[model samples]
Target: MSDNPGPDSDPVRLTAWVHGRVQGVGFRWWTRARALELGLVGSATNHADGRVLIVAEGRRADCDNLLALLDRGRSPGHVDTVVAQWGPARGDLTGFVER
Candidate 1:
């Protein structure tokens, strides 16, 4: 198998800040499950300011799917807004974690 991603298989990093009613509500666990399902690797960490930071590295399409899911209003907590930043994937993460 090739190490390089094909044209449509470009990898990316998705960093999303999820706001509102997300702390202590199994949000990170939910995100970890979804990320793993999508074959992504990263973490969903709780911020001191009551936000959940979700970072996932995988194919752009899979990452986008996860982002869409986050915005679809069906998560464990009520999500007010999701602020996202995208960049090239950094192959430094292992399995997804809830931190």
Candidate 2:
């Protein structure tokens, strides 16, 4: 089989819990923008314990790009750490949402 992934190959779900000064700094909005740009469908939600949860589903490369961006600390607020989990895509989310 070819090594390269086709148009819809390598779909996955990225569950990333972002820690640090993320809430109240337009972080979710920024995440939504980035996810939309990457053509990923998911939601960025704020937890009561000062953590931002990001769930993105799309091509593996695209999800990887988002994770890299989160780790680069170029977002709205300072990102101390990014805990990520990967799995098969559920294909339920529509557009990216900031919650």
Candidate 3:
């Protein structure tokens, strides 16, 4: 992949739909920590539909690494699935927040 980050290239944005025993489990906190460690900015929140939605922005590699970590269930809970994608990055997010 081209390492060059074009002006139009927003940071790498990843929206993950994490499932399986994710609620009430500090999953958001764990994700926030990881995102920070990876120098990413975003937020993670629990959905009423019993799933967690994590939106993160950072370098492409960092985004991929975060997804890998999630897929490996490095967090406190189990991650049944991690649906991720790459898109135009955005402005510097104000830290990782829980919504």
Clashes of each: 0, 0, 2
Give the local distance difference test score of model 3: 0.85
Tens-place lDDT per residue, model 2, 13-46, is 9999999999999999989999999999999999
Candidate 2 residue runs with Cα over 4 Å from true position: 1-8
Ranking by lDDT: 2, 1, 3
TM-score per model over all chains: 0.92, 0.92, 0.85
Give the 10-residue window scoring lowest on summed lDDT in candidate 1: 3-12
Candidate 3: where is the Cα deviation over 4 Å? 1-10
* Model 1 misplaced stretches (Cα beyond 4 Å): 1-6
State residue 59's C-alpha deviation in candidate 2, in Å. 0.2
Q: Roughly what TM-score does model 3 have, to 2 decimal places?
A: 0.85
Cα distance off (Å), candidate 2, residue 22? 0.0
TM accuracy, model 1: 0.92
Candidate 3 lDDT over 1-99, as tens digits, reads 988867543566888898888888888888899999999899999999888999998887788888998889678778888777668777767788998
lDDT of 2: 0.94
lDDT of each: 0.92, 0.94, 0.85
Q: What is the lDDT for 17 in model 1?
A: 97
